[model samples]
Target: MTTAEAETGDTLTEALTEVLSGARARGGLFHRAVLAPPWAVRVQDGAPLSLACMLRGDGWVLHPAAPQPVRIAPGDVVVLCGPTPYVLADDPATEPGLLIQPGDCCTTPDGTDMCEKLALGVRTWGRDADDPTVLLSGNYQLYGDLSTRLLDTLPPVLVLREGEWDAAVLPLVATEVVKDAPGQQLVLDRLLDLLLVSVLRAWFARPQAQPPAWYRAQSDPVVGVALRLLHEHPGHGWTVASLAAEAGVSRAGLARRFTGLVGEPPMTYLARRRIDLAARLLREPDATLASVARRVGYADGFALSTAFKRLRGMSPAAYRAEHGAR
Candidate 1:
């Protein structure tokens, strides 16, 4: 490969890492589903992000966001990237008798909780212990503005079939899901995160993956440098000319290139990133409005509040309250 190709590959890798760094799983749901034929489970709405890997037999993912019901054979992994409702079943025609609520709570459509009744084993659920179909699932329950920003770039669902992704972590997830060890939740959390990162990284590198425009722009040295500056130092008072100087380009050239590649002017993107920073900062209980303002390049609380309210449709205080005051 040429020098520019090598450099662009490096930049893409770094950008992917930076964006995925915030994907902490915490104590979210991780389960191994051992299912029989003629079974279906409806996630009656779900977490911000969840992953499912088919380890045995086959199944289907039915979501409104997808044009067709995606078949999941052995070794296929699917990433569901929105909080919208979807279903996993033996067949697309199967009607779900069970519903999964938030927090991994399983219930009937009539609101009868069945979490304890449906237990097959540790972190394993479904009809029977010796069921033929096995699936590994993990709910990310992602919080943090940075995490949300990452999810914003993804479609509602993405599927990586067998041989299309790196399955390095699949074995580990399968092995760990059925074990009830000390600190197992934490272990599973980390493992799930690793699996997610691996699958997503592979997907992003595929020709048909259709990753976001900004993500694609990360391969351009000039535009990528400009984006990195905006992200790394949202607090910095930046101008198009200053950013262009830092990126080794003329101001007009930077503007044109950034707009063409990222589909937004340089300064507009900066403002969005700054507000994202401010919103994340506001979630900190000890972070005052004025402090959040300064950290994201605003002059004061009022200035930040005006900008924040204008962009986010609410004041910083309101946003903090809505997201929980840390």
Candidate 2:
């Protein structure tokens, strides 16, 4: 076996796959926007994530914190880390006359619901149906604390220009999004995930890009294997010595290396991961605390509750109630 393979037993692509496995779109809101000049939309949906692709013409993304508006040319894709409001316009000066709220709620300046009133067609909306400025967008709610690990790494607004990477999926995404047919939601959901994964892969491949700490640890021969073992078998009772033996490293060596790279001790990191997994499981309507506890390596509900509350500052029950309301 190659040296790196002997240690980590996985490639960077495989690492990314393991991480993105949880990102599935369930009834995600998608729309095709065709707008003429003097157009802008204020998106304040408070979703965990959103993706926008410029299919034709040009536009700008205006964020409250940004000193300048970022330009989007045709075929460019943008990943928005949201819960923060932002505006899209033909020009920076064109103010938004409409507000897009949660649950696909759209309102005019006078607070009138215009969701169906402005429906151009199936999953299409805009001032003019034939407008040259076309944008396709998908809003996704990245439920569960597990997604927070991935989401924490992204900036509020990240644009992947066409020149930066080949947007091969753009054509398929554009075509699939507007279709009104059977199993369309499933098709769109898969397409959305594919497009997102492609965009993220391209972005991370950039020379100047910075990925999450856990992601960066994938390159380490020792820590990578340890992390993979922990992630793959989170339910396992992994002590430092056990993990070290499995990784073909001494316990002290593994401890120092893992802490330096992953920013936490082995068992501490495992505990956090377990709780994160538990938090995700608690989001499921049918999952009881005890079941989630066993799934994440805790002996029972009390043990799980202690760890979950200690780390997350909220009880599992409270976390479930809050997310259930969402």
Candidate 3:
């Protein structure tokens, strides 16, 4: 491989690693649920992603838009992507007795708090003492733009059957859920992150899986080099000529290949990526617009604001106000 090709490969790997690590354990919510028969809970929309694992017994996931309810057996891992509501129950026909709203606050249909009343133990909640069905759920409440690229590629619902993937961390997550030790929340958060990464990696490896364009484009010898440079150094003042030189190709050649493979010109992709990084940095409470702009290759906050608004339809301040880190 040429120097550019090797650098591109390493850059792609590093980018993937950074995204996975950055997306993890950011105020994530987890709960171990033990439910009896005749129980159903409505999960509201707006959560970026949720993971449901059936530890014992079987259950059904009812998506309103889905033609039928998805039945999950013990050891099955289900990933539900949002802005879509879904229901979990012992049977598909059962009416939802409770609703799990954003922030994991549970309430009855009449708006009565059900969280404390049904609390079973440390990090555990349930309806009945003799319940047979046990489930573990982790909710990732990521901001809309934080991991938009990765989240946009997922289906509304994804299921992994037992033995289909190596999820040894599931057992550890279960074991650690009930612990009341110090930093237990952080421990569980990291474990959930591990499980998510493992499951997604397995899912993408399937032969029939349709990976996203950005992912597939990394294999292109020409576009890959340009993408690596854009991602690895978004703060650089890059032009088509500089990028082509880095890729050992002509400006026109690099532009054509990049657009064909990545569905956008290199400059366009770079602008979007810079805005994405700026958005993430804006989430920090102390970060100023000037700092964010400088970090993302803009000459000043005004320049970044104009580009961010034209592309995202909102100013950086407004975006931070709406989806800033909580």
Q: Per-residue alpha-carbon lDDT of model 3 for 1-326, expressed as tens digits?
A: 99877766676567666556546556677888998888898988468788899998899998766678999998889988876889999999999998988767889989998889999998799977568999999877765433656675577888888887776678888898889998887787677788888888788767887867777788787778788778779999999999999999999999988888778888988998888788788888889999999999999999999999997789998888777654
By TM-score, how accurate is candidate 3? 0.84
Put down candidate 2 lDDT per residue, 1-326, tens digits, no spaces. 87856545455676677667656676777889888988889999988888888999999999876678999999898888788899989999998987998888889868999888889988998867888999999978545522555676677888999988668789888888889999998898888778777888788889999887778897787888898889889998889999999999999999999999888899998997788778777878789988998899999999999998898888998887766622
lDDT score, residue 251, model 2?
98
Q: TM-score winner among the candidates?
A: 1
Task: Return the lDDT, model 1, position 261.
Answer: 96
For candidate 1, give the lDDT of residue 248. Answer: 99
Off by over 4 Å in 1: 245-253, 275-295, 300-326
Off by over 4 Å in 2: 5-11, 65-67, 240-257, 279-292, 305-326
lDDT of 1 by residue, 23-70 (tens): 766666788888898989898555888888899999999999999999
Could you tell which candidate, 1 or 3, scores higher by TM-score? Answer: 1
RMSD of each: 3.1, 3.4, 3.3
lDDT values, one for every candidate: 0.83, 0.83, 0.82
Q: Give lDDT: candidate 3, residue 74.
A: 87
Candidate 1's error at 134, in angstroms?
1.5
Candidate 2 similarity to native, TM-score: 0.84
Cα error, candidate 2, residue 51 (Å)? 0.3
